[model samples]
Target: MTNHRTGAAEQIAMRGLLGTLNDELGSPLAPEWERAFWAVPRHAFLPETVWLGDDLTTYARGTAPQTWLSTVYADAPLVTQINDGKDPGDGERWPSSSASAPSIVFRMLDLLRVHAGHRVLEIGTGTGWNAGLLAHRLGAENVTTIEVDPSLAIHAALALKHAGLEPRVISGDGAAGFPAGVPYDRIIATCSVRQVPRAWLEQTAPAGVILTPWETPWLCYGLLRLTVDGTGVASGWFSPHASFMLMRNQRTDLRIYRDVVRDEHVPAQSVTLLSPWAVTGDDWAAQFAVGLQTRTVWHTWHDNPGVDGVASRLWLAATDATSWAAVDWDGRTDERFTVWEYGPRRLWAEVEAAYAWWRQVGSPGPDRFGLTVAPHGQHTPWLDSPDQPVPSTG
Candidate 1:
């Protein structure tokens, strides 16, 4: 009787928490989605151990029940698996899988605009909560979820079963998609991808929507929703706020090394009146513009006083580690800053041209930008229509 009462209390608490989350999200969830949220408990899908806080401190449910319950219901994402289930000597580890934040999940679902009888294919079924929710609304038979990690797939399958739902859980690469479940009315990926795969476009039904987190080397993440046409092309606009962990195969590692530069080499030195902060700071619109124009380059910033009273420096490096540029900002009242570039590619020049193009085009935001994926997996970022492709900085 005591256990029954505890379960009942938890259900009530979960309902209340869901209500709060719904309100915070501006009540965007459909009535069916809300019902599904109440029916499918997120706590059941979470693992026994999770990482908490920025430091990735390990938290076990058995050791701290209150913290576990609180975190399980929180709107924030919970890191369930790290370093592909391997231990790091330090607590800090790369998060390979996570239960996405509830609000973002709902937002993605809303963008998907699925219907009651719609056949849905979900990629990256991290913890099965999303699958459970989809199953609750569209019936388990209408939902097919795929996870790359076999362990995660098994655990998600078990969790869905425990929740009294049975969505088809497949263990395979999400990029390839599931041809068995081809012609899905809607497809969604919980993970982020550098480029939408050709298989996704080929497998989706005509007029069906594909939603996923999209990223470029210049910008970490954005939400993309593309609608497939009969011509084997998909086009869509991006939302700035969405972010997610990169899909395993799409991850890139770039670091700085001195050997890439030669002592005999000399780079052209120049100064620009543009402030680095103006381009790299909170202005995501500019960043997106730069990202689409400049390929395979990322930027980092630092603050400190140099011998010439330079207060800040912005560094850019290529993913191949073959090119690098540094822009220095001194304490001078003037807007001009010093730039140094190495390697065959002049990265800073490309950035400046990109930023200039963005300004010339009226400084559009993510919504103003769109993506076009060709049948062969080539991606073309556009300003407004698919006809006007954004040119890359050469």
Candidate 2:
């Protein structure tokens, strides 16, 4: 199996992918970016064995060259690593890293508004494809990329070298950022973060852009693009919906049944008309609002837990695992749901207030919501404008 793409067929596939990306983006791909895309072909960075789709099924380039080539050239993400570099054979395989969908990749490139001779620092050098593109666009010496995983860093470095683009690739924690690259003209993170790292604020040049995917324990969605003021504070709006893997340094692993729920613990019981489905799924706007209001809260749903009458249940827990709540839907009624809350915080009640505030404030989407992070790392989420701070449920 050839590790590289060749011949006229590969060129046609690349052009097809660009057309698909253009249609999805609602604009023809930027001329400069189009050139970068062609030069840094995505398939070259991909491992011979790739994972595809939601289930992360296997697609080997050697066994199925045509299929692998088509999948690689599609406007979609290809899972490059799973289970944090573990084999995960016959076990639960969750995406640890992936090549981002082409549309969003191009979208973020445009969002950065990069200019000639701009020095860019990229966090999360997953496959080095992005770093190669940045190097090609802004020159290799002007781009620096950091990957937390040493193996990934090595692979990405090799791939970048293979592409004839040599950017500075370092293996280090992204949260600390690269102090040596202080006053970076632009800083971009290929990963999502629950909170904006203060180091990133410290390193960005005045009026420079810091673009990253955003996550709240409640949901994973939206990109945050902050503008530096050189005063240690950076304020940014949540734009375009996209979910990237959380930064490796900022990830939390907790299982509700094993780590949170306990049989001996008793919870306060209550009834609510608010359907669990209202804020849990599809209504990303509501979820984003709730996430902002309760910064540390996260959720998961269990369907048909074999708990007799309950058809489904939504479990909510603080990221610290200090407090927890559960809302049960009995299948028959959509209007009424039973709620249980334990620990110091009335988690469900906090949710109700957050939902109410979102409703009262015209139910703005992610784009209208923004965050103002002070130098000390306190996040003040706001509505429409920073002056209108959203109330927090203590």
Q: Across residues 100-197, which tens digit of lDDT does each residue of candidate 2 receive?
A: 98888889999999999899999999989999999999999999999999999999999888888999999999888898877798999999999899
Q: Candidate 1 residues 1-394, lDDT tens each?
A: 0111137756866876777777877864678888888778777888888887677777887899778777887888889999897777756577888888888888888888988789999989998999999999899999999999999999999888877899899999999999988789898999988889888999899999999998888887689999999998999998876678888888876554453445665767888888888778888889888988896888877678354667888888887777888888886755788988988899998998999999999999988889999898899999888889998985
Over 4 Å off in model 2, which ranges?
A: 1-3
Q: Per-candidate TM vs. native?
A: 0.91, 0.98
Q: After superposition, how far is residue 137 of candidate 1 from its true place, in Å?
A: 1.4
lDDT of all predictions? 0.84, 0.89
| Worst 10 contiguous positions by lDDT, candidate 2 | 1-10
